[model samples]
Target chain A: MAKILASSKDAMAHVKSGMTLMVGGFGVCGLPENLVHALAETNVKDITLISNNGSVDNWGNGKLIANKQIVKLFASYIGENSELAEQFISGQIDVELVPQGTLAERIRAGGAGIPAFFTPTGFGTKVAEGKEARNINGKDCILEEALLADVSFVKAHKADKLGNLVFNKTAQNFNPLMATAGKITIVEVEEIVENGELDPDEIHLPSIYVNYIVKGEQYDRRIEKRTYSSATS
Target chain B: MTGVSKKERIAQRLAKELQDGYYVNLGIGIPTLVANYIPDGMDIVLQSENGLLGIGPYPLEKDMDPDLINAGKETISTLPGSVFFNSAESFAMIRGGHVDASFLGAMEVSENGDIANYMIPGKMVKGMGGAMDLVAGSENVIVAMMHTSRDGKSKVLKECSLPLTGLKCVKKIVSDMGVMEVTPNGLVLLETAEGFTIDDVVNATEAKITVSENCLVGTY
Candidate 1:
């Protein structure tokens, strides 16, 4: 059974300095806002953050970057976060840029107990530099090791008392994979229902992967780029 | 097409290459405009690497959902047959070669079909988001870019001077000047954009291009 926590601050009790943390989101879309805010309030430092993209300067894990809490970052894209880029270029932070697909597969492989896998994604580019490369089936392939974390922070649309989670639309990006990859997974959800209210088949993540559940009090749900069709207007 | 910009013209030409019922992935910038020109009655599906497939047009302001966005992080709508999945599964669709065609913007493209777009050494270091995977896995890879840099330097080069996103992967190129195919020997000039001639394309290209006998002026 997953422990149901009441506040994001309480959820931060399990996090510590110098830990490898995985935060789930694709930019600001599916980020766990309250949890991130609470983590920013703490004095924890030297975090090695892993996510798909570094959100803009004032949002998502960018807040942690602004606070100078993260010492290293592993992400697919950092073009949106100017702060992270400055830090990376100035030798303030260590950055390892991975291909988006390879990042996702590495996380998934971590949770699934796969040690490493060969991928053709970064065969001959800078991404393949100094890696063990082999020609498989007449195609060049590189071996990428699995990634695991000390803790994971995930955001979901709904959760049952049993910790079964249901994500909304594209918000499901990297949450489920990070949930299983963490030693302690803390999930923040918009709503919590009774255990039996959710259908077993509809659960995106099972209770076994979640260690704690927190009801996020408020969500900014900020849109990174708000593009609208002029034709419809 | 008289008042159309070079970027829009490039997109319009690439839209014509899309086949019916094809699953395509479009990169940021000019490639995103290709969505607006998709041929009518064609059942093309747009795949966004952020985990949505069957991407429709940009949403009206009132219908916007912050969580519903394209890989560009712009608010977007989903088609009737759209489906959502996790990042791992979304990429599996890409890395498994399920995407039929991928249209991407590039900084430089070599005569041998190599692409360099993600970074420019110390000046720009925007990481390769999903480009390497898309080029390595998609069935057909097409680059959409300008014929020359702002400084009058040719982008179609004998060898890419920038870091490569993928090697020997690009199958074709649709530029502001013309349409070219990357063959074993070298780049082949297939068609010229409206108002451009073979001499104009040859002058703008850094690599020598062999003009095909069947080359014609593009309709757009």
Candidate 2:
């Protein structure tokens, strides 16, 4: 059974300076907001953050970047954060811009105990620079090594006391995969049920992947970009 | 000269390439607009790299689900029989070549069919989302973009000066000025927009192009 942390601080305490951390989310959706803020409140520094996007200027992992805690970042997109752009340009932070699919596949490979795999995604581009390539099935593929994290922060819609997680809709995107890729997976969920409460089939991630659970605070669920039209009005 | 906007013209031309029951991915920018012009009753399924299959048009505000977003982070709705999965599995479908076609936005395209859109040396860019994978794995790739930059520079060039997203991977290009095909012979002018002459297009293009005998004014 995963330990249920009493507070966000307690849950975030596992993170330390100079650790490689993976935070699961796409933009703002599915982010462990409480855990992110908790980690920011700490004095940890020289962190390497891996995520889909570095997040927008004031939210998600961006807060950590703003605090100058992140020494390096690995993500597919960082356009939403001007701070990251400045830091990257000024050589304040090191950045590795991986193709989105490759990033996800790398993490998935890590969890599957696969050391490395070949992918056709970045072949023949700057993304393929300094990487090994081979012809697989008449197509060019570059070998990408697996990505593992010291700790992973994942947000879920529901979780059982035993740590089985069920995510909400598209928010489920990276959380389930990140859950598997982390050595210590800490989940923040809206609700926590007793063991066996979550239907086995409904669980998006198994308990074996989760090491800690923290019932998250009420989320604002902020929309990243709000667009309204007459049809909706 | 018609009332159709330039953006709509490009999208309309690109939408014609979609086939019934085809699995397609639309990149951000001009490519994203193709969703609006999808032929009625066509059963094309749109795949978002974020794990959504059967992507539909943007949802109304009242029915908006904050959690349901596209790769662009825009709120969207799903169609009947829509399925969602984790990002890894979604990408598996992409890298496995399950997608039939993908329309992407390019900053520059070379006569040799190379694409450069992910970065511009020093300028701020969103970075390659799944474009590399899309171009590498899709059966066909169509590029949607403006014919030229705001400064009157042609985007269709002899060689892409910017960092390439993929090399010699683009099959077709739908731009504001014309529709072109990338062949071993070089860039071929397939169609020109209405009110635009071959001379007008030729003057703006930096790459050498062969005009097809059947080239006509764009229908859309």
Candidate 3:
């Protein structure tokens, strides 16, 4: 079993600058805050960050965005970060706006060792300008390549010494895929239990893919979006 | 196809046809309007392919929850039991066909049921969002928009020459001029906006249209 670290900072010691990193999260949910904070303290720069959402303002991947550490971002939702928007609009940063499902498949395929897959996400628009398209069954499907990363960061609920991880509810986002798809996978779990204590069926991600496990710090369970019914309704 | 001044009216009519308890994905722009009107009591589920399901539309300026927002990067709220997910898990539902229906907008739809939405003649556009997944993965796909472009060119064509979003994925098209269904047989004219006929719609379209027995133009 690989050693478990006490903090994300120690687990992230394996990272280097200018490497492509995949961070798992959808907006604010299932975000790896500890690793993000750890990455923040590092002198690394010029990272290509891939995720579903660029964290809002001063949180999640927003930490990297705030530090101006990311050189490129491959994401579905880019509007959350005004800094990203400014950089994109100013041509200072590289941005690839992939369709949400297509982005997921691209990341998954990359980790699965699949080179490329075809889809109809952006077949005939600006997204398809330089891409190849083949007609299958009279429908136009475009080819999009896979994505692999130098590093992957994931958040989970629990993990035993063997590194098998279990995530609760919404935390089961890109963590599993990122676990398998990267050269170095860093996981932050709320709890680390005794080896063999977790049921095999409950293990969302097997130990083989995770290179490092860090016990997460206590958290502030902030709600990203709060929509309450009308007060008078 | 009726004039451009009636885009919102057609969408309003389409929103009226929605049933309760359906999980729906609303595409950008006009389809987003479907959220503004949800008929008070229908329990329609709204999914945004960027990774949010059951997102409430933007609240009024004074009522805006600073944290609430949809995948479109627009502000929104959540209903009870509404859980937040990572980007990966949210998309799995979309690609796996968990979404019930999706309301979309299009620039062109063909007689053969092809959609040309994400492209224009010469503009440099980017971002496809989850239009493809929503169209391919959802059960029912509804397109809402005007029947023709600003230059008097009809969006209903014999074949789509622009770009394609999804193939034969559009189930219904609700336009200011009329409402049509994409059947295995062909495009069936289901209903029309006020004062429009099958011949009138055909004259404005590039492809052939089949008129259904239940066709009725909208009153508003």
Candidate 4:
């Protein structure tokens, strides 16, 4: 029986330096804010932060970049993060720019028990570099390997002591898939209730994939860019 | 076809055609400009192939949330009832014809109304996101493109010389200088932007453009 922790700091106690971590969140929508803050506090260094984008300027994953905890990052979009841009351009961080969708699926496939899937997504571009290409039905597709992380971090809406998670609507983003893919998936929920408290059907993430659970500290849910029209309608 | 300078001129013309309550997927580049001109309180549903369901317009500077973005990987706000999913499920929405309309940017549109915008003529290219699926799945397809290439080559042609992304998928076209619609009969001349004439359009194009009596020049 897994015991529920009170805070992200407790749930993140097991994480160590040099570990490969996969985090969920498209932009910052479903991010694990508390656990991320916990990771930021710890002295762990040289982590491979695998997520959709590097957090932009003092936000979400950007805090990790600021802490210099992540030495290598494997993701699709770094356009949001000026710190990441500086680090990459300066060769201080190693970056692998996977196609956005491909990166998401590779992690999903890794957790789905599928070793690899062929896709036409990155066949001819640099995303196909050093990868195997096969011709199927006269069309070329490159075989991209599944990616697995030593630990996965996810955000959840509510959780029971048994670790069943209920994500609030769009907050379900990458929580469920990353749950299944990581070897040690840590979920930081907004609230934790008693066992059997969460509705069975409403459970976005089952207990089987969750290794640790904690309550989120706070949420600012910062946005990246804002281009607007200032006119009276 | 219109023979005016493209850039923002074409974006403005396409924005005027947008109706309320449409499920729109804006293609990259010029097509993304449609977001800049959405009518106030139109309630259009914007879909992104990257798995967002309820995309509102881009957020303002004070309200910017780094986490919310559209398919172009730029930050965006969401309307109520927005959902998230894996890429597989997102493609299902695109390939399943659930989208009402797709507004795309094209490299060329043939007389037969074929579109070629995914690949370049030479060298390797990036992956096709959901263009093929959008072409086949959307109930309606609208193309917004420039009348001519930078070298003064016509994009509205008799036939597409480039690789086609979708066969006869285009319905209406909005260009810098003109608007055309693919009909059961043939390409119907709709209108041209201000400062362009039929012969000027024909001269700028590499193909033989058809003219109609209802060709009034547009102002937007």
TM-score of chain A of each: 0.97, 0.97, 0.94, 0.92
**TM-score of only chain B in every candidate structure:** 0.97, 0.96, 0.89, 0.87
Candidate with the larger lDDT of 2 and 3: 2
**TM match of model 4 to true structure:** 0.71
TM-score for all models, in order of appearance: 0.98, 0.97, 0.73, 0.71
Model 1 preserves the real interface contacts to a fraction of 0.89
lDDT for position A4 in model 1: 96
Q: Tell me, what's the RMSD of every candidate?
A: 1.2, 1.4, 5.5, 6.1
Per residue, candidate 2 scores C-alpha lDDT tens digits across A1-233 of 79999888998679999999999999898889999989999999999998999898977798999999999898998897898889889999999999989999999999899999998888888888999999978888899999999999999999999899999888988899889999999999999999888888888888999999999876878788775456633
Residue B132 lDDT in candidate 2: 86
lDDT of each: 0.92, 0.89, 0.75, 0.74
In terms of TM-score, the best-performing candidate is 1
Better of 3 and 4 by DockQ: 3
Query: Considering DockQ, where higher is better, how would the candidates rank from best to worst?
Result: 1, 2, 3, 4
Pairs of colliding residues, candidate 4: A28-B67, A222-B65, A222-B66, A223-B64, A223-B65, A223-B66, A224-B65, A224-B66, B2-B177, B2-B178
lDDT tens digits by residue: candidate 2, B79-126: 899998999998988878899999999999999889998887777566
lDDT of 4 by residue, A30-66 (tens): 7897888788989999999888778667777889998
Candidate with top DockQ is: 1
Judged by DockQ cut-offs, the docking class of candidate 1 is: high
